[model samples]
Target: MLETRIKTRSDLKGLLMDAQDLFRDATTATGSKADELRNRGLNLLDAAIEKAQDAQSAAVSTSKEFAQSAGEYVRENPWKAVAIVTSAALLASLLARRRD
Candidate 1:
């Protein structure tokens, strides 16, 4: 099986769902083959969970860095940031109105 990069929330949800389904089947299985399959599933689920935790930690760190950098930039250029935000909000509102 190919490992996928869980970069988005949707990807994480999908991985969790897959792991859950496998676990559900594993619990109901019997005999040596079933035991083998269950062990494989457990290993896969464990790896996926570890990877998810690592990704979450990395994401949190990256987001904090980005926010700190953005805060510094905005503090140095307050007016520019305000103007940009105002323009973006205005454009979003206009787009919403057009959709309505």
Candidate 2:
């Protein structure tokens, strides 16, 4: 039932927010519980943020690698790449004319 109350990400976020507020204002028994929950939630949030940054970094690195490789390929076969693109554009234009 308690876990069901936090069935979604938004619900968990609300819980974390409440815990933070309690920890901020607590001076009673609730303070200890609030502190524990707040710390755990903060840890989870920090770990998630770290993993996301790592994934983003990896994606950017991969994209740069792909772009560099593609550039090298184009440089190594400039005329062939140009002819292929030109042929595709010509075919597209011809098809569009027929459609009109």
Candidate 3:
């Protein structure tokens, strides 16, 4: 019976060591996976920022061209442009008053 008890204790110690090793391996694996995910997230964010910058630059260029064309059109039709502006102003004022 004493020999059996000693053997059982030895077996328990070995199992404990194995459990500890498994826990350590799991922790290391989780940390490595987290680092990989973090790197991927940062890369995606950088790509999104670059795409946004490109889109903003395109929008600015388009706005400039549109403004230039509109200016020429307004100069060619001064009375019509004035009438459109007045109508827009009136509409804006009416909308503002309604909001209030």
Best by lDDT: 1
- TM-scores vs. true structure, each candidate: 0.66, 0.58, 0.56
* Best first by lDDT, ranked: 1, 2, 3
* Tens-digit lDDT track of model 3 for 1-100: 4564465456555545555555555556667775665555555455545655655676678789999999998999999999999999999999999999
- Residues 1-100 of candidate 2 have per-residue lDDT tens digits of 3343334444456655765665565444375686775677577666556655655676678789999998998999999889989999999999999999
Model 1 scores a TM of 0.66
**Of 1 and 3, the candidate ranking higher by lDDT:** 1
lDDT at 91, model 1: 99
Question: What is the Cα-based lDDT of residue 49 in candidate 2?
Answer: 62
Question: What tens digits encode model 1's per-residue C-alpha lDDT throughout 1-100?
Answer: 0133435445667666777777778778878867876777777677677778877787788789999999999999999999999999999999999998
Report how far off residue 20 is in candidate 1 (Å). Answer: 7.8
lDDT of 2 at 15: 53
- State model 2's lDDT: 0.68
Rank by TM-score (best first): 1, 2, 3
Per-candidate local distance difference test: 0.77, 0.68, 0.68
Worst 10 residues of 1 by lDDT: 1-10
